[model samples]
Target: MIPLAGWLLAGGSLASDPAPTQSDFGGAGLWQTPTARMAEEGELSFTANRTRPYSRYNVTMQPLPWLEGSFRYIAVTNRPYGQPSLSGDQSYKDKSIDLKLRLREESRYLPEIAVGGRDLGGTGHFGSEYFVASKRFGPVDASLGLAWGYMGNRGDISNPFSIFGSRFDRRPGRDELPDTGGEFNSATYFRGAPAFFGGISYRLPSRPLVFKLEYEGNDYRSEPHDNDQAQRFPVNLGVVYRIRPHLDLSVALERGNTAMFGLTLHTNVARRSEPAKVLDPPPAVRESAAGRGADTAQVDWEAVSRALEDNAGIRVSRISRRDAELFVTGEQTRYFYPAKGVGRAARIVGNEVGGDIDWFTWVSTREALPVAETSVELSRFDALLAHDIDLDEFRRGVERNPPLPRREHVLYRADPPRFSGGWSLGYSQNIGGPDAFILYQVSAGYQAEYRFRPDLWWSGALNANLLNNYDKFRYTAPSRLPRVRTLVREYLTDSRITMPQFQLTASRRLGTDWYGLAYAGMLESMYGGVGAEVLYRPFGERWAVGADLNWVRQRGFGQDFSFRDYEVATGHVTGYFDTRYRGINVAVSAGRYLAGDWGATFDVSRVFANGARMGAYATFTNVSSRDFGEGSFDKGIYLSIPFDLLQPRSTVNRARFVWAPLIRDGGARLSKRYTLYTLTEDRDGDLFHDNLDRIAD
Candidate 1:
């Protein structure tokens, strides 16, 4: 039997085992070494640590139960970015990507096993690969691992894989790679002499603390840039305190003399929460008079439409009836969770139409285009509405469908709102290759859209710099291909107040599963373009296909109406797939790019339970790696965070961040403001199907 003494409640229930906390280097580990333990899936952690020569900022994500990923930036205070003349006195900055995969789960008799790589696709400053196993016994959790490369610099053990080939005994040093970084360095992975590392973490009984002691494998004698330190002993000691519900503080003594401190701010994206919606009006449920079947003309649908919009968050454009079915079609305005709005619409219609209606169908639209249809049987729903049946049981009678043709009778029609916009703070970061030449800008941005019809609108945005460090932007664009995206530096420092976008957009529902979008204006900061897209997404399907075409001219340094001489016709035909399991979404696009290059781009992302999306993408074209310059190709990671997750009220706004290892001009696409796939996100996907159980929430 497993010992209960070591198991303690973390962010989960008391029955759940104590989960691993963030390591100083930004993953789940003990002191400076990693363990086989993995954080709970869908958790995001931000960690900052300071030791001696290095300070690190890391963002780690658990996109899957058995997978972990992290992106970190390490600042080497003792090292300059480059020659002092070019980089000034700024410290050196190195970015790294890491990934871990679980091979086996911990059982009563077996320890958990995991294999991972650090600094996999970046500069090999901290490169290493390892295999680890961990187990728990009473109050102590023990781990042992073998590592290669930087972490295994001690090299006490022989190369076990060398027997197979001579190449297995050789590991390349960092000096062999390009200084611009961004390479996978797969040839040297696990090829060096290995070393053993082990550690044990003790959870204090009834206390929110974990005491850790570890034997590190890295001797620090072969540090990059010759910044080596003396290692009197391989042992390190540390302790982590749960200072707050969402905060972790760790202090450690490492390398026999150095003092280390780190803090991690983390949350489970799978279980995000905000203040309750107690202040918002509840779902309105009008009762039938004297339990009698009523007439259709007696219902004031205009009032019902207003109620649906006000309380249910559904903007009613029209209401119809066919036999005992009442159809209410409108755009979803407020709720990101379709189930919540559908539930409220059902209650409002069910109560207003009385016993005469047997089914309620709410068709949700994007712009004027129908996307998803939710039909709820009144009899089964009444039980749920009354709390007699739980949500799961009530969902049995629920049906999700595509938008159907107009019903028999029209009851109400109202136009959607004519204006929508907001003012928000925006931040952008620019990278002029690697080696710490980064610049950031903060701006006050205002965007508004004026609608002429439900399917047509004109939108524009103006940004004024609030705070920035543009004076430090001194790097020049490096591109052998057409200068499609390399003009970022000029755009960043051109003008403080600029209008990046002012566009007219229109969309149409071509067929039951077809959507078309067209827009023209200043498309993005780097380019001015006109583009159109069409998407074919079947109802209740996991796959979709789309094609887009655009003609674009580069925008001027002033970001105004003036255009540049460079122009190109670029487009792509893309296929999108959603692996409904584990919230993974994949898309592949192939066609001509902005720089007149032909290639394919592959994008993969994970959607957390709270609507946050974390994704990575890569592009490879006909251009050779040497011509494409450092990083070999184009690759980046992006995170889209919904604003509602941190607000007191609900919102459809999001904060998007994209970090490319190095910026280049190959395989670039026009950055359009809206795409058909994004506008019709609620259609025939996981949004409604996976959330059917929340109909009464």
Candidate 2:
């Protein structure tokens, strides 16, 4: 099965009923012209296109109904990457970010309208800005747009902004310096002469073919790297072959001279569903209340505890019964969704209790600390077995809140596991850097955890390199700031068999609405630190705030376990918010960085229905662009995919992949192994909203 990963951008239902198609540039458009169209929300695609001297690869995501974002890499085959001695025979590559916003939706009397910018906040290689409108007629989609800069090199129309000042009369030429480009040049935006462009798409009914023609605003009179090519005509023609629902092949003739070929892979994350858990054991049969007897001693607590762990994915901490309610306390381990654990627990307890117990409450815990609890009316649950009530009706009768500090009538205390470990394979890589196209390593690793108690534990990871191509990682960019993150090459090549991280961590419940965490020892591959954090998150609320502080010393290149003389103190005060709409989350952190720089970071992401989070983050500080080197700032994109999606049995573990255009030394944060916010997410009440469908399963 193909893995579907995504990131945020504008989105909406496809225009004109299945009208939007992936353009050669990987956006929704026709050939070289953009249209006011969008992919369905939660849609993502990877596209590669080639035309003459240029080859472009793009990854586009639509996380919202009115936003779209794309990250692209353009390789100019005709130009050298840098001095031949540094990058021999390597083609110059430019990495850029793009965004499109839908300003107006199509209506009976108006065309859909959108505004966007290309190669934004990056090198001016293909920088441009435009606003376009698109409408659909029977079997055809039409789009018209006005653009500035590279896309409008034809200069067919005067700059509309020229009325404001003479500064708008000319577009600043791109700098010829060999420096890496990533800073945003706002002064150059919408400043050049403009041009008008239009295009149309023709789709045959009941067929898998799509035909398109576009009037391009860019002429081949001048090009990036001063490599201009001749054009035979002003218009472009293209065709798309839909080989499968998620795959497309494109062929196009642009500039009447250049032949283009492209491929696109697409998927929608919002509508994904997990396969039925046929292998999981069925819920225990409901019992007759009168037959179980009214005496509590008749209950086999040990047997019931084992059943909960085996059948409901919950590891029991303790069990107790009040006048009419039974409370089971533990952490969910097997079900990726906590609600599923709750549902299964309800079924298992129904078979153990009788007429005496009228309600069931599960106190969910993490690190043996109670975070939240859910109470369910047994009568409502029993009705589901009799088909007299639906899951939604039963859900309405349930109640949940923060865990209260009290214990009574304790029946059983579970024996917690003391030791756990696992073996796995790992792969890491560096890409799109000017020095080399890719530098990678593969290894076999083992991770183990030993819990002294439920609230305290020691853990470590040891890895042995199996394969790597770090020989090509010879260049290290000079940094005026401390080398906090740029020494990645030295760490990777220092040792073959090494333990990069070894730490001891502990967590505690400070109060009903607060949590505390602390850790010490070897923290990560680059540094060793001791840190503590406190979080104040209300029970079942949508927002939280936290603060953390740490003191760290750089690690030796031996990579096994050694410290360097360099040390610093760093931390952040972070705020987290959940919009409660489409799982959109926004996070901001401000404080001192690893390099002793003051800055703040902004992260925005969307959590899909399938336990996947797609997000991007950017960090800026007082460090100047010249001192920060390439990238001008710190930024990257990441996708965290739930383990359950790749296997039959459910597991909450996730595999994360990160991509950064360049690794710099500024805006670096301490890599804390565990965070209180994530540890207590199950208490936020989103668990039920995200996993409500599992209630009846």
Candidate 3:
């Protein structure tokens, strides 16, 4: 019977767990602890829960089918990190990272099984390890688990692994004054007596509510900071109300005395609204080219170029005719899908050129260097557009070929304006540390650009602070390494208005698959630098590689084009891989950092179809954990959300948010403004093929 149950569970014969019916502290569960349930893939949630001495703000994401990760900040009102200073009142706030892995899915006669670690990275004051299983029958769900460390403080049973050695009988205490916080405290994990906990949840019929009851294992007498309290009852009770599809409210009674309240906001990043197109009508397809005449005059070619740019969003550099084929060289902008730009250009060409033109070839170029060429039969294209025919037939005829050698008979060339400017409002923030909980600023900036040619340009930005609280940013972490990034207070408080960036950039395509870029300027908030990068990305390939080099001088606190004495040279060789699994991408960079530390960084992210990207990265340098200061290393999570998701019209703009536990000097990179790989992304055909339906627009 046991073997049969195992086979069923392995095959995932049972329905997946439903959405959270009750809050589990700050995640998905019943009351005080998590269940064996996992959230849906691509789910992003923010949860805030409070009860007496503890309040937790958590950001969680299910980036894969069998994995869940969360970053949390817990504020302990009863304790403070240290005596108050100019940094403002100090509260005992702890930053923790958690993860869970699913082992087996539930079946008709079996429960889902998972293993998890909480407070895995931090001071380890509330660290715990557990293995849990859950199952559902009708409207009721039940879970059971065994826990160790703080969760097993009751010490109800003997040490489970004591048979191996006497050292496994007791958990080791954590470092009380460590320089860093993210080091894994393995010696203290699952090394003590174990305890059991269980819970049950029931859904109410005809109502958007769920009731929960749980038996907690921790006795609360072993809490950190000598802030322990008595637990009158082992059971916890709670209820959750689903206020809307994206919101939930929960309240719980725990320890038979304290009341807990939680609110959760969640959304699926993979789901997005349909494309919001403009009201302009699509270009009309001509039935025949009978009346069109071939005029290779320079004026005629200029008119054709204007038609392509105004109607099709293609900026033409040159146009020529050779025998029965028409060749146009240009760059594509404005459309998310290159196929749409190509299709629109084809229709406009057929409308202007004579019937003798049998083929239309477009040479896609970036920075005046041709990358790829696509050829289409003008006769077949017109037929597909004018009649009811399979669009696939037209797609099959489209050919991606190498660029042809230079043609001699150019009819027209464009010379565009050299200057443009705009104004925008932007915001920046720092969060989650012993320093003030958050330091933020809102500013308005005017940006201007001058183009020397297609491959060279100059850009600058001047900012005025409209609102800020930088005077409150006083705390700085202690570190043995050079203070490459910890002088935030001096930088922000120097001036209310500043010039964050001003640079001149030059870029060019070196070969069919190689691109290069060079720039010099005040690159970012803290430094002015000169850098160059080269990338080799083949069309439609899953992997690419690039290298970069930079020489920089630290900027003065005034942030007005003045340099300090500090100088450094840093660079990296980076590789990128697209897994092709749910839009996951992995990048690894190895090089020297700003503080002269050598290391590698690993980043993984998933980009949804709607252009929303969620990712995390971690850096490990040669510096020891203690020397690296808080966080042990450099790590953070970021989200880039497309503006189109909130706007009524489609746009390519995005807003980015980043959260880091601490800012240190060990593994920091120069923040360059642009890269060649992103500039030439449309050279690949996959993105265009994925959105073929937009070709008409």
Which ranges in model 3 have alpha carbons more than 4 Å from their true place? 1-25, 159-167, 176-179, 274-312, 319-332, 337-395, 399-411, 683-686
Candidate 1, residues 93-118, lDDT tens digits: the string is 87788999999999999999999999
Candidate 2 lDDT for residue 204:
88
Whole-model lDDT values for every prediction: 0.81, 0.82, 0.77
Candidate 2: tens digits of C-alpha lDDT, residues 1-697: 0123222111222223452577766689888767889988877777889998988888888888898888888899999988887777889998888889999999987999999888886787888899899988988988999998777889998898999999999888886333657877777789889888889999989988999999989886769888888888779998998776666789999999899999877766565555556667886666766655466668888888899999888899999977888999998888888777888898888777777788899998887778888898988877866789887787777889788866579999988889999999987877766667767788999999999988999999999999988877777777888888888888888888888789999999998899999999899888998999999999868899999999999999876678888899999999999988888999999999999999999999988876777789999998888888878899877767676655567776887766677778899998877898888887777657667667666
lDDT of 2: 0.82
TM-score per model over all chains: 0.93, 0.95, 0.89
| Count of residue pairs whose backbone atoms collide, per candidate | 0, 7, 0
Q: List the residue pairs that clash in candidate 2.
A: 9-67, 9-68, 10-67, 10-68, 11-64, 11-65, 11-67
Tens digits of per-residue lDDT, candidate 3, 1-697, equal 1121122122211113335643444456678878888877766677778888888888777777677777778888888866577435667888877878999999999999999888887668888888899998888989998888777778788887899998789887764336367777887778889789889988887787888999888899988888897798889998888676666788989888999898776665556443455533456565356656665452377888888877777789888878778888888644555677777888888777776778888888765557778788887776677655567877866777767566557778887668989999987777765666767788999999899998899988899999977777777667788777988778888898888899999998777778899999998889998999999888768788999999999999988979999999999999988898888989999999999999999999987665667889899999998788777989877777665554444444666766677788889998888876666655656656666656655
Q: Which lDDT value does model 2 have at 100?
A: 92
Relative to the unseen true structure, what is the C-alpha lDDT of residue 299 in candidate 2, on a scale of 0 to 100? 82
The candidate that achieves the highest lDDT relative to the unseen native structure: 2
